[model samples]
Target chain A: MLRAAVEAGADAVYCGFQNATNARNFAGLNFTPKELQDGVAYAHTRGTKVLLALNSFASEGRFELWKHAAECGADCGVDAFIVADIGVASHLANQLPQQRLHLSVQAAASNPEAINFYCREFGIARAVLPRLLTITEIRNLKNEVDCEIETFVFGNHGLMVEGRCSLTNYAVGVSTNMDGACSPASHVRYERDATGGMTANLGDHVIDCFAPCDQAGYPTICKGRYRTPVREEPYYAFEEPVSINLMDMLPELIGAGVDAFKIEGRQRSRTYAGQVVGAFRKAIDAILAGQSPNPIDLIGLTEGHKQTQGAFLTKKWR
Target chain B: MSITPLAKLTLGPILFHWDAAAKCDFYARIADECPIDTVYIGEVVCSKRTPFFERHLPEVIERLERGGKTVVLSTLAEVVLPRERKMTTELCAQSDYLVEVNNGAGLGPIAGRPHRIGPTLNVYNVQSMVHLASRGADHFTLPAEIPGNVAALIGAAARPIGVGIEVQVFGRAPLALSARCFHARAHGRSKDDCRFVCEADPDGLQLSTLSGGPFLAINGIQTLSWGYVNLGAELDAMCAAGICYFRLMPHRTDMVTVAKIFFDRLAGLSSPDEAGACLSALGLGPFENGFWHGRAGHLYHTEPEH
Candidate 1:
């Protein structure tokens, strides 16, 4: 996937060790030490940077694990460490002064004060803004913050505040912030109901049910359907499963002083990531060259075959 | 055995959007009659709701202080707008009352100053706690879903730094926060034109599963557990684990009586079972204590299961 993304013209590719150190701690995903070394060597030769994601909040009495991951990532010659925890950032700033640090979106540094905190405390070179800000808010934020700003251009349009949400932890006891996995696959169960409907569950809790003709979505707690007294039928109380596609707003985001555009879904397939990256690279180049970019077809690849501009375009999304 | 049997009871800031008059009345009652030792005041959820109550803060603070309650101002849990940043900065700058920093945005201005870590900030490990403590945080309120083992470890780590650890022993656990206001959305309105729809549900609008089982509650942009978190059975265990403070999140219920019950429980005037029964008799629950047992937050683990 690193080679594919680099070849697809990604300036930087971020990945993680096969452990709880990163947010995408899915089984059969992520890299071993040798795999990371190989990926870094391959990307560096092609003028692409490899950023290590040590983004999960360290569990109590488990800071050594994150420290060890950071040491290993450094030894592997990665470009920078994308960190979320203050302890990890402080450690890197003091111990490995030369290593560049980027604040992960998992840090939820949505404001200038929060971004400045990391930049001042840990000498963070960049901060990934959470996906909750509108373009106007982003522009205002860029004026006050010292570090480079990165915003998500594509992928999951999470409704909840990053790093702060514990819906998954409340359900299955595995936390996205601490364990780096939300709605862990091990606890998810899909069962067929009597009426040819499907019920998806996380642990013993029923997250949602889909009729025979409906396409079932992942059993994330936020995307699930629930009943309320006001409505007779079950409804998506939080959000419907939709992917965020910001291709149309790329020019405005660039004008908002965004440093880089991030494409989420590290756990996705190489083919899909490469296709999306290649499409984005072309669009960005066209915009820089003062031309209207030709749109690329990515609807089929989106979750639930639906896409939304999310909270980026206007405050109406709220 | 409980190491600190006499933990202080605290009233967490009101998460719901009550009218200023209702808020003042609630606090006046709390200040005069409640046994709560510390009262956290400020808007911790939505930044838009701040203006409605900002004018009443000084009066509320004076009343609480006059009643011999230690008051702490809390910052917003999520800040994205410039005004929100300014609000956090100004809150951090105030030195009269200790501030509880809920978001990372609050940390910068309060750095090197004595403050408290609210449950919204992530302080899962000892290193994070130590680092924040070095930056002058004297106390912490763990996130609502933190399990007992992790809380015990954090409490143990906090001991050496002479910092206090607080856990929410009562309330509907705050499960998630979002930029989108579900309350307004449910009413077929956008957030900017919300018209204060959330003010209708004083205890948060309830959301149940499709099966009609209680699932979660929505209060504006924040999601809370449908079941009230009652850790009456684990109070002694928490105290033994070095937890010296218990917070009671204010709902529309009679919080004064709730605080008295918890105070009595801590003072050993009532047994755990007695306290648990009293809380149940209040009818504010279909109670849950699963997070303490390292299970689902909505589950109520029996004594045998524990």
Candidate 2:
């Protein structure tokens, strides 16, 4: 993706170690220490920066690994560290004072007051705002917050409050907050129903199911289909199977003073990553050049082959 | 050896909206009869609902104080608006009560002042605990879904610093909070025009799975576990690990009896199994203590003999 991103005129690329250090700790992905060293060299040579993603919450006993992740990237001359846990932030602030820190969306620092706390104490240069914030809220937050604000512009839409959700933890033993997986494939069971439907079971519970020939999404408890006995209908009570595509909302976000555009799906393949980065790259550059953002045709990679502007387009309560 | 404090029963701030009369009547009962040692009084969920119950705050505090229960006021979990920020600031400024911070926004408001940590703020690791301790936090309630061992480990780490730890031993555990009001959305209303609909479900409106299984509850901006997290059986384990406070989140049930069961189990007057049965008889949905075993929080596994 480094070459693809640079070739696609990207200014920066964010990736993480293959271990449990980042939020998307999928199989056969992320970089080793040597790979990171080489990747940083490669990206820096092309005037494109490489930011290390150590965004997962690091709990007790595993503090050393998270701390090592910070040291590993800092030694590799990486541009910045996207951190979530206060423990990880504390380590980066005290030990690697020179390394620039960006508060991860996993920190859930939505409001300016909360974001400023991290900036004042941790010296964070940027904060990836939680997807929960509306454009108006983001615009309002930018006026008061100290650090640069980043918001998700495309890819998977996580409806739950970032950093604080336990819906994954309750149904599955692992959670993104504690364990770096949400409905991780290890525990997910796909079974064929008598009616020729596929049920995505997270452990013992059926999170969501799909009819035959219907595209199925990863079983996340919040975005799953559910039924209340009082209501005869089974619907996506929390959120539908949709990826957020904010290409149409770029100017509004830019006007709202969003410093960076984050593309979700580090869990996707490298080819998938490059395509998304390249697509968003063209759209953003066009917008920057005072031209209308040309919509990128990338719906095939979406959860249900559908995309939404999500909370961005919603008229939030004043 | 460090002194392990006897786990005292405490009542958390009411998360659901209740009318002033019912709210007063409930606190009156808690103040008059319940064996809880502490009572947290204030609106931690929505700031708009605070005014309806604000006038009765002093009387409730006075009544609880007279009943020999320590009362602490709690700030809202999420503060977005300018008024919410001012409200949070004013809540922390109160000289009469020590504010329990539900969000990090309160930390700045209560700077250098002794405060308590609510479950809404993530106090997962020892470093976060130590960080909050340095900022004048005297007590903490670990998040509802955190592993029991992690809570105990945090409690142990906090003991030396003179900070107390609390575990939510009962009630529908608060699972998540959002800026958007899910309760309002379920009713086809925006948050501003919510019309106080959350008051209808005193326990909270349960969100179920496609299989007709009750999964979670929607209480305005917060999503809660449908199963009341009754750790009556695990009180022995939590108390042994230096937890000083046992928190019971208020629900529309016979809480005095609920308190008695936990109190009896803690006092050695009843076995945990018996306490569990009595708690089950209360009929507040299902019960879960799976978080204690470090497994799926919704799944139940009997405590294996250590």
**In lDDT terms, which candidate is top?**
1
Quality of model 1 by C-alpha lDDT: 0.89
Report lDDT per candidate: 0.89, 0.82
Residue B276 deviation, candidate 2, in Å?
Answer: 0.5
Tens-digit lDDT track of model 1 for B153-186: 9998788889999999999999899889999988
Candidate 1 displacement at residue A289 in angstroms: 2.2
Q: Give the residue spans of candidate 1 off by over 4 A.
A: B1-6, B303-306
TM-scores for all candidates: the values are: 0.97, 0.95
Model 2 bad stretches (over 4 Å) = A316-318, B1-5
Candidate 1 lDDT over A1-318, as tens digits, reads 887799999999999999899988999888999999999999999999999999988877778889899899999999999999887888888888999999999998888888888898889999998899999999989998999999999998888887888888777778788889988999999999999999988887889998899988889888888887666777889889899999999999999999999997587898988999999999999999999999888898898999999999989999
lDDT of 2 by residue, B120-229 (tens): 77777888888878888889888787787788788888888889999898888777777777767776677888898888889888777766678888888888888878
Q: Global CA lDDT of candidate 2, please?
A: 0.82
